[model samples]
Target chain A: MKPRVGATLASTTDQTTVIVVRWGAEDLDVTCGGAPMVDARGPEAGTSHPADPAQQAGTVMGKRYASEEHGVELLCTKPGSGTLAIGGVPVPLKDAKPLPASD
Target chain B: MNITVLLDMAADGFGDRVVVGTREAGLTAQALRARASAGAALVEAEGADAILHLAVNTPAFPVALFAAGLAGVPLVPVNYRLGAEQLDHLVGNHPRALVVADERQRAAIERAGLTARTPEEFLQQTRTPAPHAVEPREVDPDSAAVVIYTSGTTSAPKGVVLTHANLVSYVLGTVEYGAAAEDDAALMSVPPYHIAAVSNALTNLYAGRRVIVLEAFTPQDWVETVRDQGVTNAMVVPTMLARIMDEPGLDRSVPSLRSLAYGGAAMPRRVVEQALREWPAVDFVNAYGLTETSSTITVLGPEDHRAGGERLSSAGRAVPGVEIQVRADDDTPLPAGTSGHVWVRGEQVSTAYAGGGSGSSLDADGWFHTRDRGRLDAEGYLFLEGRVDDTIIRGAENIAPAEIEDVLQRHPDVADAVVVGVPDEEWGQRIEAVVVPRRGVDLDAEALEALRATVRGSLRGAKTPDRIVAWAELPRTPTGKLVRRDVVAGLAR
Candidate 1:
């Protein structure tokens, strides 16, 4: 039988969301915007996600949904121009860089 | 002598009364013999050298034994609770062994698609002459009689070899210690595949006692059985004992119970104390052993239950003919009061493992290193601290899980408990406790923190748990051993 998941949401916003995904099955693929969020290279990395991710994000309209309702935040900026934060108090995002959308 | 001879002796002693079987299908001596004749014919047709019997709680066990004995084939009882992979490994490893199962186990056999025969069909097809021409094989004292796979608590299961001599010795030893008599009656709830259950059966058989076997134990049924049957003795685990003690009507229901023998895992002092208070007339025995020893090696008798005495925290002294020693990591024997790995040597010790197993757990010097850490008091009583593998390294200090489990169980709200060490980068391993609260009791972090405070007050820092996770029920093996590793692994995620 599949184990029941017990998770409580930290916060959620229109641009980004942070949900506690307590991983019941191991080595699970947890994704944000169809991109992997957890490292899957070590023995600890199972076929399923192991724990609830404290952070998750995506781009919305022209502004990046950097910081969601949760404490976790995402960063968007041009190289050498510092960074931009759209939510949860604007601040310079550390090591922020921009890239073109994948084909 | 062959086990058949022993069965015959029992049949001769018990006569038409039930020798072995379930309540609905109990068999007398004549019926048992008839079934054996039928089973022998079926074994001949199957083209298998031996029979692999698999049933958790069947009345047909004694009949199967008799049939195998008459057929001059070995009977290996497989634990039904094991997974498909484990069954595949055992069956593939023992190609010559044919499975004899009841309807309940047919699906499992078919899933593996292994060759198997139903108990009824085996009886029908194997019906032939007494096969008196075939004499029972002489059992070598050191040879394997049954191969019981160890619970894969730390690793995969390994088949433990138990010789007939070893089993006989253990049974005889228990009979002597427990003072079992021919008139005694035993109530058993433990499964037969486990060493303790089998040993209990053997002990009863040797004494010509009437053993009322329960298919399994429910709290209500257990209490009713003891009360109704006037059961003189019972073989139980700590969990079963706790359940019975907590049962509402238990005080009046089990008044007839005279003796309660428990083992397979350590019992919490509070549970033991409750049992003692509820059933003051019953003698409580603490037995310690493994499948490798065919059952018991050390027995702490009822007299050792003295509170605030030297034997209070001990597992008890070694039974007659058994020797226990504590050895350091270097294998050097430690003096009394020094804690280390507990080693044992006795008449009941199995010579080796089955299925090409290799280990010197039993060294050349004849001592079997039990992998349990404990000290011997000046009075020669043994105290089991915990398994060497279960030890947790918190910072620089090592902690034994049993010490913490004992403390947690003493809490008024805690009904059952198991302690495990989880991996932690900062401390190497941190102690975590999984607790099952008493029925109808509600507990929260604040209550657990209070419980931890009680532990600290009673046992100081070493026995305190780092974290407590409340569970509805602890996962356990079919034999009722707490699955500490699985619990810890589950919590780690």
Candidate 2:
């Protein structure tokens, strides 16, 4: 699927929803619970998919999942029992680099 | 990109953490979200076009900010210190606004014939659970998030419109989400009307830090609050910093204060030096910006302050995502170290003013003419000379008041100083100064002579002040910005 910053996506195999925070150079094969995600209009519209037990690693709300090789960053907007992956590779939680807060 | 999304992120990232007011009684991130939802429901029910807050910085302030976002109404924080007639004039402009004001301010809001709520009532109403849950509406990132009236020193006040995307861009570029330690707390002293206050609320919340507001600021009270709250980070304007630094009775020691950020106006070199000496361990940041720039565009970080040299006087380098350039009268870019008009371009710069549809302030290229005169050093450090409008033309030579003011500040007996151009028959304009003497120092004729000689020696004689007057205190806006118009009018009289 094509990744665009601020675009919301919902898992096809679970109730996971995420927003792309950063896009990569190429289209991403992003998936959750062993199924590709699709554009989500509302919460109810994305929750009917059943998760595959093998890929139910779960996603944490507000945590950012990043693929370094793909240069993509997705922020979890809703928690679900679905592991977020890109091209069958599980995405790692992006570490926050604390900068001096500009207020 | 909507401002509410930041609140949503906070609620999701640290739902149980206290993010507003005092930690013991403050609303947690989750609680705040619910309250804001209820408040948004109220706003929608009322069909308000805007949420105007005429109150001091308090717990309700942050709630109103988020609620307005959720309601898709721009939040307008009016200066609580405006006089009756002035307040009436400003409030009258927002006839469709739902005003949340303090007790004393209710009369003005009523006079404007608008719906009003007290701070307590606002809090309670926002906290009251709705009979049925109100679904949040999708907010356009380009929509107005906040409308702050510029503190007009030389002309009538104009509203500066900051969009949700502008603020979100600033926060996303500057802060790492949920970056603060679980116990980290920020002491917010700037008034709610100032851009610093609004930006501080959003950025600190996004960083997962609790914010405690000081309703009124006294040097001793600020220090005590920092100590009492175990505040790790705090923000103050230059005037506030000067007061805190010079207060002889202050204990001046805060073990928990890890970072102190100051902006709003030019910081005196002496004040910064004294503060460094007083608290060597604290990280001091000198942020330089305007309301139109969404708070800060450049920052002199702690490392630069620690190194201490000419850079201490600079506004530091431009922050990531902001590009700054100095331009000449012909709009050509000036060479490095050559002072000229400061121009900035960034995602955070607001391109329009209220009722003034995209004025010439923003060029076709998206670059905003800051109307500030400054120069970037060879190393890219920005040194603010003064406002372009503040230039004093003496016999065809343009002189910046900041240059003379800096020299006056170097005087040991001078506590504060401001230089302005005065009408003169001989020269196009003559430079005049207003000085606040240090406490207990009698500024006699001999001392005045010494001050004049100091300025003449350091700067050209034409650039020196033609006349100097003593004032107990200069006229300043609520946010500590010098009201130069008042000073000039007073001098004229």
Candidate 3:
């Protein structure tokens, strides 16, 4: 893998988007719609892995983002169907528009 | 009543000699006195009540001395190895004490819900344009000077009471017998919170020799320090010495080292032999004592080392002015060559224990019955068999585990050995040996059987260990004393 930049997308065709924010050192701060979300992995999981998206969705209802900055990995999840607002900015989902058929 | 006066007098008495050295700080007797005077002034200005010293292996020990001297209060050197619970116990036990600690220990102290000042803050409080000086006090021979906590075997740590006179006696005895001179420079890598380090520092200071203190012991750092600093003498436990010897470039690096003083635990014969071969010119002394005695009461000198295996097996004769004897369980004195309780009486013996008053080990007759069981040869040399409590009673016959462990440690494949007695229905206790083999050495059941056969051929049938258990390493105290109780408890688990 080339090391994905954002929170893992669900089914590759979902209109929802998850964006990750990176911080200093090894700390990972994962937030969704201005609220903190528990990473997807089990409670005993390493900070890098969020194994259960459903469990995290119940805890934090929003779109998500995951990013690596300064050696620190962050995963953020956002909520809603169309445009998601995080850190006072709106991010539109690419899957919201229909894709053209290829030969 | 004043410690500064005594230090000043001592400094004047022995001038132009090196007193203390850290990698960053080096001071002669005159310089140390000057620095101490400056530090003492700071303590006076700060209005500190008591100095709670938490720096165990730092070069800032002199600051503690200065603070204690100026404040005219007790210096409580807390062991850093303790957890917050134990630290809280110590703090609650001694209230109104000003804490002196380094940056690394600040969080722990804070976590323990205590406030402390950095050494810099303490110095700032006592800073003076011209350092105020005080005369050394005429300390009572029996007055408590230093309170050291014992490495507790079973219960919480207890403070050992050592008086100035007791320390003075210990220093004089060791210096005189060990032939310490002003030209000598001793390296101290052991933690300053330990009695060994404190006693060694005090003795070296009194002798007007330089003391080079290492923050911690690393084989490379030890070798480099000895060579670069021209260190002549050092005190170490057997495990540390063994590790240093195992370091790749130790022999070529530590050529300037002259004397190697071993203590904390009995020196295995093989380790001593290896040390002798590696550092042929260095004088190896086996020091035997406890926290109560300050440092060493008996010293097996270099001449004894030269005498080979037989002498190596003994803990050596008592140092001058110290008398030693063996006593039975009923307090009756035993004849020479009899295994019994070891009793010692000397000026260096502590007058009492903190919080509990005098210890029961010290009788009205003035003799302190050390719980160690040992015998004296015809030449008056003391041979420590083992602790009386550690003796295994197998089929009604007492077997010293140390005796067997000593033999096992001599095997070529064995790196270390510890012997314990497990519960047995018939014998009451059964002998079990725990061994750590040398790195990369393969030891199987047959090899262990052959080693047992070797032991069987060398020792009596009753002394042979019934079981041999190989381990990666033995559990040790922070000060490097083998944890026999922990080992036995591990076996039960």
- The candidate scoring highest on DockQ is 2
Q: What is the C-alpha RMSD of each candidate to the true structure, in Å?
A: 29.7, 2.9, 30.3
Cα lDDT of candidate 1 equals: 0.63
Give candidate 2's TM-score: 0.92
User: Comparing candidate 2 with candidate 3, which one achieves the higher DockQ?
Assistant: 2
Give one digit per residue, the lDDT tens place, for model 2 in A1-103: 6745666788887667887767777976788998888877644344555666788899987678888888888878778888998878899998765456656
DockQ list for all candidates: 0.00, 0.42, 0.00
List the candidate 2 regions with Cα displacement exceeding 4 Å: A1-5, A13-16, A20-34, A42-44, A47-97, B358-361
**Tens-digit lDDT track for model 1 on B405-481?**
87788778888888888888888887788899998998898988887788889777755778888989888875678
TM-score of chain B of 2: 0.98
- How many pairs of residues collide in model 2? 0
What range of 10 consecutive residues in model 3 chain B has the weakest lDDT sum? B1-10
True contacts kept of each: 0.00, 0.43, 0.00
Count of backbone collisions in candidate 3:
27
